[model samples]
Target: MATILYARVSTSEQTLSHQQTQAEAAGFTFDHVLADHGVSGVAVKMKDRPEGRRLFDMLRPGDTLVVRWVDRLGRNYEDVTDTIREFMRRGVTIRTIINGMVFDGQAKDPMSAAVRDALVGFMAAMAQAQAEATKEAQKAGIAAAKAKGGEEGGVYRGRKPSFTADQVAAVRDLLGKGLGVAEVSRSTGLSRQTIYRIKDDPAGASKALEVWA
Candidate 1:
């Protein structure tokens, strides 16, 4: 009956860490936390993600799973609803930080079940809508950035990385030792995305000052 928090970080600079902080501040405590980094919640299915599969395996009957929101479960409405229903079927209690909401399967009454299902569907739809909105916003932002970059003397300066050289090296070392990205993030204070960026392309991800000289 452990209380676990699952979070997803799409990039190193993302504020996913605040999910945990906010939960704690809201008087919620977790015995463990599982996170997936550098992974798009919009595109990736929860079960396919590295840490996400781990979560499915680790949780047991009577355990509580806490997420910042239902969207963290998945982006697709069908996928999110299915996952939540499966968890509830397993006697797992799912909670959200945004509204401090809980979805439980303990209610045997037909009306209670109907209400729960309806609410779950609503949340899942919202999650899917949010994901689509985010993708559109990202496309607009990139277009804007490109327009600015093309201006005279305006080099296309990329966003600065959040990790340091030493941190990158440490992450590389950990990956070399076969440590999983989530574990590395927990052990090194580096976001899973940052660690994966280093793992995928150490040289490219280096924080070298080589934008425009």
Candidate 2:
């Protein structure tokens, strides 16, 4: 059993470092860190993400799972509860950075169990509600922008670009030509880590490039 940290951000522009720092500051030492970038909790289920799947597979009995909040589990009340319960049933402990919430299946006392369950239910519901409100607010903003002839929307610059397709492709071509990752990085101005990733999984690299591009 291990201690695992799962961090997620809706956009690539947002880094997981902040969440990681919080978890570490809270005295959690993660043996593994799973992160999902550019994946929205409002639109994506926890078990559906690439990194999320690995979290489920890697977690074991007696292991502890940490997230920034209950929202990281899901954007819906039922979904969050179901996911948390499933992990608990498997003997995995769940903890959240916010409020230092802890949920474990090992709570044997009836009152303690009830209190924990109720807290989970309340927090999960609030997470879902917050996500819904955020979605509604975004829609309202978009509608208001349209009414204003897209002027307001145009004024709001979106997330910063993390990677580009041409850069990825250049790295791929260099790797295919037997160039070292460091050499590819020097040529394309991308990091050696990015080049190694492209070399390791060209298909996934292509998909990321397409989505980000």
Candidate 3:
């Protein structure tokens, strides 16, 4: 009966911390959080993903599943609708941070049931449509960039990382303890994305710090 937050961190603009903050701002708190980094929510089915599969086995009746939105639950309309219905059938409450939408299967009234099901279908359709649109937009952006020219400055080394050498060590320590990204972010006063970068490549992060210094 634990409240779990499941997030997919793929975009550079919206990292795991942003999702956690958004959920917190909506007055939602979780006992545990699971995230899948670098996984495309638009292309991959939820159950096929690593942490996504864990959500199926880890969640029990009376437990609550929180996501940033319906789109975070699946890759397509059918997938999202099916996942939500299955969870509701198992008496698991699903919540969205976007509009504070709640889907429960315990409703005895037919009218309430109809409304809930309708909303689910509509949101799932919208999620699929949104994913398609985003894909097309990315394609266009790439085409436009190619038409313009190649990189002006040979190879671009990204901006300097936010963490110091000591901070990187601290991040590694917390990560070794199996702490969640959000928890590590809070404990070390570092951004969740930074923690993720370090977790993925500790030595490279250390080298980057030295190079910038």
Best candidate, TM-score: 1
lDDT agreement of model 2 with the native:
0.79
Clash-forming residue pairs, model 3? none
Q: For model 1, name the residue pairs that clash.
A: none
Ranking by TM-score: 1, 2, 3
Which ten-residue region of model 1 has the weakest summed lDDT? 204-213
TM-score of each: 0.78, 0.71, 0.69
- lDDT against the true structure, each candidate: 0.84, 0.79, 0.84
Runs of candidate 2 exceeding 4 Å displacement = 150-213
lDDT of 1 by residue, 1-213 (tens): 899999887755566668799889878888999888777776788899988999999989999999988877877898899899999999999999998899988989999999999999999999889879988998898778878878755755667667777777788888899998879989889766777777878888663434423
Between candidates 1 and 2, the one scoring higher on TM-score is: 1
Candidate 3's residue-wise lDDT over 142-208, tens digit each? 6666555455533333457788988898888888899988798899998666777888788889888
In angstroms, give how far residue 175 of model 2 lies from its true place: 14
Model 1 spans > 4 angstroms off? 15-17, 151-155, 161-191, 201-213
CA shift of 153, model 1, Å: 6.1
Clash pairs for candidate 2? none
